[model samples]
Target chain A: MTTTEPGTAEEPGRAGPSRTQRLVMGGAVLLTVLLVGVIIGMLVRLPGQPPAPPAYDSVDVGFAQDMSIHHTQAVQMAAWERDHTTDPVLRLLATDIEDTQHGQVGRMLGWLELWGAPTMPLSGRYMTWMADAPGHDHREPGSSEPGVTQMPGMATAEELRRLRESTGPEMDVLWLQLMLRHHEGGAPMLAYAADHAQTPQVRNLAAQMLAAQTAESEYLRELLAQRGGTPLPL
Target chain B: MASGKTSKAARRNTPAPLKKNSFPWGTVTAVVVLVAMIAVIGTYVAVRSNEQQARAEALAPFTPTAQNPDPSRAIPGIVIKEYPGGSHVGPDEQVAYTESPPFGGTHDQVWAACNGVVYDTPVRSENLVHSLEHGAVWIAYHPDRVSGEALETLKSKVTVPYTVMSPYPDLDRPISLQSWGHQLKLDDANDPRIDQFIAALRLNPNTHPEPNASCQETTLFDQHNPPPYQPAPTPGTPGARAEDESVDPSRPMQTG
Candidate 1:
């Protein structure tokens, strides 16, 4: 039923008129081919150009935002511990955490700022990306998984106020407890990002962070025990 | 049958006028296709142009604000940042800078003493960047690559105030001369262009954001022991590349 005969009826003289029609058709096809070649050339060169960098909601982006804010609290609490603790080991550890975490904070913020992504996700939407895993959102415990709704292990405003206003051994104990919980809360995000971040650098940073925080958490628990402190219930 | 006969007569009478009207449709079809082709070609050209434009901006963030804006007349140095920046950094804080042996970006509150001091060890990057903001020139060399006569030749160039010389392990070039908004990498100890670069950009005022600011000051950091150069253990980061004398600037050096 599909045939080239529809246009054949319109051709009056096969020799003269058909030749002219064929020439016009050839010209149009050639023009289209030339135009298509230009499109292909542009596409072939596209990957070589660096992308506009990460956007606000991308995994690499969301990880940087969440971790930067997460690290800020650690630095702050470490400073609190530095001010409150008298134990030489605890003081040294606080100082170490303060120094290195502040530096890492600087690096992370530097990357986010350079990438033009927000330093933190807009309020309320934090860690919602973790919703990707099934059934765990309910099983995650505390606010979502560790404690509180903002992020895993994040101290509530009331808790931060308490940590800030408290003094002496109480302050030391509070600082240690809060920091330990914070690290534990941060674990899921880091673990997720380590396996799933789009950028190699993001993955590399997550790996470094996982190792460092793991070691620090172990040290944190040991110090808590040395002070005859028990781990806070999640 | 009578209507068909009358229509056939009308068709015969108006054949030339009808043919003329039909010719315009063929022209219109060709016109439509040509317009479509132009649109596609235009879109591709625009995207390609935009990509090149973005790359060009990324390649040179800081342009030479020399008294003369002529590129050829400008001192020969690769563009570092394709953008201009002036962010203030805290004196004690660590800045994750975009360039190693930074030319200019956010810098610490205090400037390093550029009062004709030739440091034997590498100075803190924060202070060095601050000094550049005050319109001083910094000459950084690899400790292993340039020494003895080459070292002396470089030092002689830094005898005046607002100039300082030190070792920078991260530099891919053996020596790089930096003033505010400009830097030139020299393979040889005695490139005549070295002097030209200094004379053109140093305290040029046109390039310096604060030309009147003093370079003679010091605080916190010791005169003798500048922070030791330590490369980051993480490979491919700027800190990791700090210890290696990465030779080609064209190759991706650490950005943050």
Candidate 2:
């Protein structure tokens, strides 16, 4: 055996670094791993925010519903001209009206279904859905004079009767005149729906209706002028 | 004896019980991390599935199609989703026909036939006829022979100078009273042919009538207008007759 110095010889029980040092190193490694994990987790989570559901209550719903009904009537009157009128161009014009309105009605009904709502909302009043309209003051249901309370541009009972009674060119001219007014009433509501509806589908369909009806209105005006008739004062 | 005693002492001292790590720290940590990831991903999938189910259930009750709301209008709104066309070989064999407005039967049945579309109800038939008159054809039948028969009959019976061909004879609708050179109107109550066509058509209870007063008029069922009004063939003769150009507004055919 050789003589050993007091300090140079290690304690038999101690083999390496002290426990504190080992702990410090392990902790450092753990911290680095945790830090990297957290950064990756944050990056992975960033894109997860969901889109919001379309927000609408009865107002938007009512416009789509009621306006669809209004358009149907207009379609009916236009169809009458398509059949009885001898004019080929007029007949073609009526076809356009029917086709466009058919599409519009379908889309509106689609919205009601999408929203988990009833087809005919149980609202008591007509145009109440438009109550918030700025300065528009649509006629309240059942409030106006008995006769004039008819939806705007709707033909009077007498006028419809006359249209039924007349034949040939007379029927043709009157039908066009009445339909022009009917569409005139529809344009404003279409504009409102376009601007205010909550759903993109609703707004898009409304805009299309507005554009189509407006164009149709122009055509009807020109047609009336050609027939030596004027637009019925709304 | 001294050496033996030293060994015994060494044995009695015993090495400290070797430490056994009862808690597998590394493996436990790995398992915990894996479990956490699974939990998070499972939650995400469940949420997504729930949302999809909600959307599907919401759309389930209302079936959608390209059908017109009014059935009577010419363009019945529904059409066959697909069709293929071939080049025309000759006018006699031509499949293309002029369609009038209120375009109906253009392609296919909306629901029933291989090639027809049906609109929802409330729209009247007169509207459909008017559209047809204006040159809109509701694609009625596929271009196959059986489907082409009605079209051929329509061509022969309704157009002026009626000439019929085989494989598609003129189909007489006693209700329509549509024979060679004449077709019944929706409103004409007096035409024996129309009455007959009506009687035959009644076999199909679903057949809809054109709405309103104009149904009384003598409708030209086929789109072809007469090549100027030729005088009727002299009694008991089959040769050419005189022509009358004047519009006889009063002679509108009445069934009553």
B1-256, model 2: which lDDT tens digit per residue?
4444345435557432221132235546755665676566567678878986665445322211122121222221222111111111211111121221112222110111100112221122223333222222221111233234444433322211111111111222211221111133222223233223322221111232221111111233221221121122333343221121122357652211
Restricting to chain A, the TM-score for each candidate equals 0.74, 0.70
lDDT of each: 0.66, 0.43
Per-residue lDDT over A47-99 for candidate 2, one digit per residue giving the tens place of the 0 to 100 score: 66743333334556777657755665665566667767888888998878877
- Per-chain TM-score of chain A in candidate 1 equals 0.74
TM-score of each: 0.44, 0.40
Span of ten consecutive residues with least summed lDDT in model 1 chain B: B61-70
Candidate 2, CAPRI quality class derived from DockQ: incorrect
lDDT of 1 by residue, B27-99 (tens): 4787687788788778868887898557534532222222233232444554533324345445444555556
lDDT of 2 at B28: 62
- TM-score of candidate 1 against the unseen true structure: 0.44
Off by over 4 Å in 1: A1-37, A45-47, A135-148, B1-36, B43-256
